[model samples]
Target: MINLFRSYNPLNILWLAVLVIALRIGYIIGAPDKLEFVFVESFARLLVPVSYEYALTPFLNVLLAGALVFAQALLLNKLVNQFNLLGKPSFLPALMYVTISALFTPFLILSAPLICNFLVIWMLYKLFSLYKGDDIKSSGYDLGMIVAIGSLIYLPFIYMFLAVWIALIIFRPFNWREWIAVILGYATIFFFLAVLYYLNDRFHTFYKIWLPLGTQFPNHISINNYTYVLLAPVVFILVLSVFKLQQGFFKSYVHIRKAFQLLLIMFIIAGLSFYVKRQFQLNHFLLCVVPVAITFAYYFLYTTSKWFYESLYLLLLAGIIYFQFNTF
Candidate 1:
């Protein structure tokens, strides 16, 4: 399976579809009784007046979400290759993304973070463009607005505002206007939202939108033991990827090195920002999948030991399927 996706091939799409179905087989078996069809976070409804009621059955919902995530994984693969983040173009990023997106059952469904991933990809594209562009302020504004829009879907996503500033520091010289542009662009979204609230005579509730930012970090989260067991392969792969990154850190090009640094910051911010939601959901961690997938791709593409990497990849897939079915 690893060998099949190591190269860039259009035929991989068929295999990817098959792989998606395989990963989702557990959800399909349980169907409408055990799975949820439409999941909307409380804050999501507060931010957006509309609700998503597809009127579709649970099986159809799972199928549609699987299709959407697969499509996004492919798009993310293209974005990484287009930016030369992996040093060379390959299908490994897309393959890794499809695998990781199914690591948890919550991630298997259509959720806010899944939707926000499109914004994450867009922000990354704009951030990479900074390497060659002269207009830092315009790029900063665009990134800020993208983060703002994403925050509307998942409030914790506002944390990505930090990535915009961090990317500016990585790609360009110090500029105060660039910093201010990010703030202004972020405020622009809420400004209109406030007006909508005022027009509806619910202006007082506008302040409540920021309440999540004040959530205190809990001392403990009750994670199932089996979940940790399922995480073993993922943790192992990330450790290897980090070691691999450190080994070649200095040998990479200047842009590529800085890009990886930016991604590292993104992973940290995305992971830590989950506290802002106050309610701990595995779905929130989906925010980290983009950077994590890129890191995995780097490991698979550059590692010399074919058997070791192949075994690791297969182990991850097997663990995901086993845990998915056993969870019930």
Candidate 2:
């Protein structure tokens, strides 16, 4: 794996960049309503304090949001690159990882938590790479601070506390100091966001946002249509891989054995999806999507390296374009 990175050609980077751009173009072309506004008005109205006469501009929000989405694609790409050594997920996998991040992950640009996604990825990377007794406490504290800032942007992102704590324990075992730092992270979000609310004169919204457990919010909603766009094929390959694992195909193959980390990441995303949906917070949240993207990237390369698997991915891409591209 180390040699692969060192020996990789510059053209490969260009190819990956071109492919990523192709994905952005395809997404813009096929987006439902295609750059035209639909329901963001309601959100814009919700962004400003009721007392403020001027609502935030939807145009600016979406334009800014588009930039964030593009940035997320880049981040997801780098994330796959950074972690690929763990699973050896490749350039194609990076594309798939990024797509899943953008496609179905919680909180799209319309949601405030987009900011959290950016911050959490960096913190998680640091957490994932930490060594034994290497200041998990400080990392956790920094993680907490990032969450506090993210929550100020979108309140529910406080949930990222779950990710931060879990990552700390999984990737780097911690002691009492780290746990305290995690607690500090949670408390900091509340304190800082409250300060923002007080300044905005919308102090009441802060309580509703922070103490969500008290509210009887309606079930979150989403349309599952066209998930076959990617899910069916990805699932089939995963099923085959699972069967192979059961049959001991991976007994001696180190990379195949290690790829289960990608599987774990995928599971985390799926679990978080249901968690977010139950709360009616259906925006494309970063937490749900980041793992999904990693899973997709891992498997995309996994399938593409085999003749049968490569054929399947081609068919899947063709089907997705056929089903999804007509709107373009």
Candidate 3:
């Protein structure tokens, strides 16, 4: 039983999960009257009023996503193991990825910027997850699907396909089949969305919904705040871990450099999300956090230096202070 439990866990996954849920609860509890849920939270609220139990009602959508987060986690677990051909990674990696992803949850459709940002990260993760496969068509299809699905969520996410194509050229040379998958996947979303557009009598109004929301002025979100608490020590260790990994052959489970690829893809996603429209929100870029945390957790927990760990904790504490001050 001990071995089984150990096999299932390593560092702080459960605690992290609790913390993630708590953050959402914090938002719900501390929410100002007009605050309702964030943009996508409103999507859930659409199904049920705040007076009803969030678990059993409109909040079900959020609950569904949370459930999907686990499914996504399972897929990601398989990804790390398969990409690196490394045995199971430590639990810290899982905690970091899942919890950080959750930290960004309040943003999904929080506003246009957040929606765009989350979509970018989702596409990037899907791209990185395909690193180990030999079937170019399959990988291309996956990439295409990510582009389409993410684009459907927020149209600007379609631009993420540029990174996908570039990464394909850089990492795995392209096959025409990949292009076919991308086109097909994209067409699939359009077909359904087209149908919905007609139903809404807005087939001509694609520009209205698909158009970028007017860029809002920058709101008050300091990187220092989240970096200290929500992101914390993991960020410090993650950057150093990359340097450490570079010092040696890409030995471990990720011979294909899946985790590294994940970072690049997510960074590109985050960067592109911002460039697509400037009015960024704290929750918007969260999708990137999942992979960010994962890479950080795996690399940080396994770091060989006390200095790195200490610096990380300190930075996190700084972030916490920032969070407390901002009430973020």
Candidate 4:
């Protein structure tokens, strides 16, 4: 399976779909009867007028989420290839994405972070374009709007707005206008949302939206110790990937280095942004999967030790399936 995805063959997509189902099957079979599809944040929910009674059945919900994951995997794969983020074109990013997205059952369901991933991909496209050194004030504004839209779906996604500036810093010379353009673009969305709040006589409630931003990071989160065992393979793979990148870090192109820097910054921002939400949900980390998947693909793409990388991938797959069934 690892070798199959290591090639860029179009036929590999069929196998990728099969892998998606295999990874998700255990959770789907054991899924509870009620599976809520939550695509909007609490503040946005109030304005959007969602009906609780309109929820999809668990099977269909999982099916739709699986389809979304597949679609996202393909999009992410395209993005990595388009930018040549990986040395050569291959489906490894897509494969790694599906695998990591299924690492937690929470990631298998419909959630705000899952929905926001599309915006994240979109932002990456614009971010990468900054490498051309073209005037990108418009791009900055667009990225800000993307972040705003994502924040409407998942509040933690607002942190991605920092990525807009971070990309500019890494990819372009100092341009204060471009820097401020992103802010204007971000405010552009909320400006209208504020007007809607005032018209509906709920303007007072609008201030409450930023309240969560002030919440202190938690001292600890309640998670099963066994979950760490499940994550061991993932952590191991990421560490290996980081070390591999470090070995060749300076030899890589300047743009590749800057791109990786921006990606690392985005990963940290996405991972820590969960603190803004009063309740910590594992699904929130789905935002980090994009960068992590690309990183994994990098390692798998470059590593010469075929036997080791392939076995590690299989081990990761087995861990996912076993834990999905074990439900620990």
Q: How many clashes in each candidate?
A: 0, 9, 12, 0
Q: Give a tens-digit lDDT track for model 4, residues 150-208.
A: 98988889889888887887898998999999999999999999998888889999999
Q: What would the C-alpha RMSD of candidate 1 be, to one decimal place?
A: 1.8
Better of 1 and 3 by lDDT: 1
Per residue, candidate 2 scores C-alpha lDDT tens digits across 170-232 of 655457788788788667756755676677687766545534434454455555666545567
Q: Which is the leading candidate under lDDT? A: 4
Candidate 1 matches the true fold with a TM-score of 0.95
Candidate 2: stretches off by over 4 Å: 1-7, 24-84, 87-89, 101-116, 154-156, 172-174, 200-205, 214-224, 240-286, 300-305
lDDT of 3: 0.51
Please identify model 4 stretches exceeding 4 Å from their true place: 52-54
What local lDDT score does residue 97 receive in model 4, on the 0 to 100 scale? 94
For lDDT, candidate 3 versus 4, the one ahead is: 4
Cα lDDT over the full model 2? 0.51
Of 1 and 4, which scores higher on lDDT? 4
Alpha-carbon lDDT, every model? 0.85, 0.51, 0.51, 0.89
Could you give me the TM-score of model 4 versus the true structure? Answer: 0.97
Which lDDT tens digits does candidate 1 get at residues 210-297? 8889999889898888889988889999999999988999999899999999999999999999888766888888889999999999
Task: Highest TM-score: give the candidate number.
Answer: 4
